[model samples]
Target: MDLPRDAQHDAVIVGGGHNGLVAAAYLARAGRSVLLLERLPATGGAAVSTRAFTGVDARLSRYSYLVSLLPRKIVDDLGLRFAVRRRGISSYTPHRDTGLLVDARDTARTREQFARLTGSERDFEAWQRFYAMTAHVARRVFPTLTEPLPTRAELERKVADPAAWEALFERPLGETVEAAFADDTVRGVVLTDALIGTFTHAHDPSLRQNRCFLYHVIGGGTGDWDVPIGGMGAFTDALADAARSAGARIVTGAEVTSIATDGRVAEVAYEDAATGRTHTVAARDVLVNASPHALAGLLGAPRPPRPEGAQLKVNMLLRRLPRLRDRAVDPADAFAGTFHVAEGYRQLQTAYEQAAAGRVPDAPPSEIYCHSLTDPSILSPELAATGAHTLTLFGLHAPARLFAADPEGTKRELLAATLAQLDAVLDEPLADCLATDADGRPCLEAKSPLDLEREVGLPGGHIFHRDLSWPYAQAPDAADAADEAGGPGTDVTQATGRWGVGTGCGNVFLCGAGAVRGGGVSGVPGHNAARAVLEKAR
Candidate 1:
């Protein structure tokens, strides 16, 4: 289990998450000696799919559900045999006895639904105009993510439209949402993107919500979140295959204990769980596919502030899709896309206030989506024939702080309350539709922020590894500007250059969600890190 005494490689990758796998594949394919170390028994990280219930044939996307920010370039570049199917219904939000369903196939019906929900077609018009502007921005900015860092001024100029730039990048997202949409439900739907896994309100001057919103909307240059054909696990599995086929050595259950470098060559020490023996591998470059906080600890440096995640994740196997209280909308259509519950604009604000005050929201704002409805490949033939389905719920404004006092007690209370909120919008209780496990227990599982931190190695369970950041650089001088200007060399003490993956150490780089433009299932940081090293070699 221990690496050879003189083991060495051109690149040593820490953490075998999707990003690490990506870096390995690219580096190895380029003919660089590559070794990737993963602490877990598997390499998917939080993006893996699992059958939570015993004796169940369903494999649910446990933590990260949907894919949006992952670029098509990564898919093609690696020759990954994976595909994503777009949801037919964008979203459905119920209020009282009625709902607003946005059917992608039927814009006329969607327009009609919007009018019924808001009592006017003006909001729909505004929605179209607002998204058109975002689409413009998406087309302009998304391509730059893989390129060298561009300064704020450069990105603004590239954006061209000053009005769009100012509305999205300069001002608070809540202000933009309120100015564009008059209907509370409509406003809430738009604002949910800004709040997903981010613990900030819409109007915060910090603009954290804006960053989240930008990433959500600019994905694939169209902002549509799609379902992976098999499951999230299949996507990462493809990455792993690509890495191995390209000659990257992947070691699972090998916990990286420390990393040391001198701006030239680096030494990585890992403990092989199988042998409980530590081994060291020397490499010309080190890619850290872990959170910044973890990277700091590994490098014996001061760690950043612990990130606080604000959400509750629940996965369930349903005997049958829950019927909606609004009978006019079919259960398949309602659950196929994002099903909003108690997420009206006012309700969202109130929930934020309650959570900020160290209490669970009276009615948690959450969204549910049925992966089975889109792709039944995760289900066995028997389960599929029985009309079984998988439902994943994301409860917002339930911060890590809320579970500090009593993790299990809080999770139990929060899950019940959140489901009750869903029940109010359903014809019957959600429990009525749950498929029992082989152990005769309800097929339900809930993960709080605390649980994510413990299991997934996410600091405070912050899903993005920390707060989401602007894809482009904010500084007046791009980090790599000097390099472009034929500067002497990369700053060894703070090595970040063009790709935003650079660690302070010259030979070390970040290739994970903590890197700029690096959240979600995107392999951008990994690709960028490899590019940086290859460029340096050139």
Candidate 2:
């Protein structure tokens, strides 16, 4: 059906990020008229690629750099022509003069390396057993992401392993890691997943780290973060294509200011950035693909506490891979996978303590990877042939609050400190390996939490939008659902039912990171929201 200019759409999706595009495509394919409005001149949000430095030929996955949480079901359902290349090595963490290298392709080598680092095979044996448990949980739980919300009891039964569930879900991740690993570096490597973008201690009673760890380990039922071939934009670009082909109208530079709903129908008011003219469109349902804070502002509801992000994102075009202090490892092999820096278990706890005290860590912990090593397609032929590479570093314990007073100054100070940590494990200074732009400036750029908020509209630069949620339904006897609504994106009401994406108003649903099981680059929330609309219609 050709929708008239003034026709009420079946769905009006605010924020044409990946999730919005996914929802629009699904709905439109189901013969529902869909209109997607985006504030930015472009879509993709954080999952986008761009040349950070002027005259640079390499396109970097500037923000969210890997493809882990994105489901293959979404890719196949949408027929997105995208691919991810796995690195041969999983990770490498350098200790004094030596390091621990986990090889994805060769477990025997990884075991040997572990034994060499820790002076015994006990930690390696424990590592294998611990991840085996997570793998079992991942296999059981990952499939539930695209399905309707399952009750906690139902999910628990599905997991089957009591030990795995208790270690991952009940106990603090710190206790679990401490019990499982003897080496500080190995323990830190395992715990890094729990603290990425989350500003929390390992032993925090809140179990926020546990939630973060679950999402990281459960992606695609394997938890391997593969490099998106042709950069991160490839996924969203394909999503946009699929949405348009399915007859969804995508309006870029349209700022959706407010959503007015009365349970049954909704009016979306947006201002076109180009014309500076306001337009209100009626829709049977609305899908929000923005942060919880943005959603509250749109619905004219009380804003929740701002979620603080805790990482400094740095993107760089390197002339060549930096040499490592450990001569046993090749730079190519080291950069091919995640290179751990200043992230020993004790170091991580100390950094968290310092950051919590409103100071940058003396030595910032970080995970660095050279995406070009696995997928050189992100670089131009010239750059790729010249051995030029892309380095993406995610610095931890640098919370948004640390940069609130002076974002620029703190960003510079933090970058200096973070790079200093990286250099400690390297043979030479990282600055010397940076490629120069046309204007002769180093091709390195760092984004503090404030920068993410300003540029990507991420509230407080919380990349997962807010704290990640458990992927199950609350118990029937649980406290008022509205009170238990962990994020502003979720607002339970009498009309809301099994779907976790539902809002207080019946006609609105969240299809963004704030939605349950909706963080990362995964389009699960969008898929679930569309499914909810379909189920309601049925």
Candidate 3:
């Protein structure tokens, strides 16, 4: 919907992702005239829910799934109408007839399962202690995500546990995992969080994995990644509704072309994607909810090094949950939470090494989780009664370059390889249980990073926009500090402050995942960006 641009808005937000929607809501709630423009026909960029399988009523969270980053404050402040439930089964990793399973409600069963797999009670004890430390760190650090960032020294003091800080921040995550568990499967399970959308050796001296590891562990005050009730789209829907109710003007199918700031106000030029009619509107300030690269293009700034995404997303509607070869547990138990397939520690390293060298691995280390198992709201009554379920798979180490050479062929080969790996653990072939779509085609679709870039505006298909930045305020090293101290081009991150969302341009700011402490579906970036704008307006 296009609104009359006769009057100027206090702020204009580009893009309609959850972050963009969030920034608009908060800015408007503060009594500012906010106008948000989105390129897509509808809001909710990647956090979308769609009826993936035609002829089926199943609405799968197409891109992003689960909930952990969104804080309770945003939910309560917006009065958003949505619910998230905890998965009963934490995770299941099958190895032949027996597998390692973590039950959220049953510790005794979990311990027994662990003991059976490792043949030792020590590993389970270590597992409990290790997570307990992470839980404490999560409670301490998660609150700061939406607030002003503290310096590294202050955050470490606040954490107060030198060992915990060093283990997570200073050392390689693989070292911590290896030290904590004897079994490779358990170690791999722990390390998976560090490499969600990132591709790097766990021991990379750059600590790229460290930042990724921290974000995953410090979400939702419990570090427990939970399932969204309806789908990821529910969160975006609620966010959009909140923004609209707050008096924010949200214009969809409005693709912004350029932004001109005269160190005072910004003029936003956009084209109506449907009609091809271009419009330019002025705003007192502009909040860019697009990627840093996307914003750079709009401002005609020098582009940074391209970031690459590393994951293969496969959405499937199953006729029935495939039977687990392990007879001790039912399919429901295996498919509930993160169901690890061939994701052992050594196995993960092997895949990473191969993918890093531009070759797809023979066996990919990925995981599957069934949304219907936890919340059946995503599926229709008929589908539910017919034992239909929605399965989302995340394959690691399938970087953008791997598909660059052979997009379709590589995608097909990787998908086949990953499913074949999955078949190795299950009693029956995964393809056999796939439901048919409206056209009678199998209900399964795979996406590579190349595909993600074309569909969604993720440059290089990076999920977090770029590599996740450290949450603290201090400079990592002397070289980075020198860069911030005017050794070269402008350092936008310097103005990003402990909580500031400035993009180095006084009138322009980053309101997307590229912003400090900006990642996930949390809405922290949006909330913090609004806070920055409100503070400046005052």
**lDDT of the candidates, in the order given:** 0.89, 0.88, 0.86
Q: How close is candidate 3 to the true structure, as a TM-score?
A: 0.96
Clashing pairs in 1: none
**What tens digits encode model 3's per-residue C-alpha lDDT throughout 1-538?**
5555666889999999999998998888889998999998899999999998777899999999988888998889888898789888989999878899899899999999998889988889998999899999999999988787677898898888999999998998878888888898888888888888899977889898889988998888888888898999999999999999999998999999998876477899999988899898999889888888888788776777778998999999999999888888888998998999988989989999999888999899898999998899999898899988999999999999998878999999999999999999989998899999989999998989888888888878888888888877654353233322432255543335436466666677788888878778889889888887787777
* lDDT of each residue in 199-296, candidate 2, tens digit only: 99889898999999999999999988888999999989999999999999998989889988776778988888888888889999999998878888
lDDT (10s digit) by residue, model 1, range 287-320? 9988888888888776778899999999999999
Worst 10 residues of 1 by lDDT: 486-495
lDDT for position 194 in model 1: 93
Cα RMSDs, all models = 2.4, 2.7, 2.5
Candidate 1 clash total? 0
Give the CA lDDT, 0 to 100, for residue 411 in model 3: 95
Candidate 2 backbone collisions, by pair: none
Q: After superposition, how far is residue 85 of candidate 1 from its true place, in Å?
A: 0.5
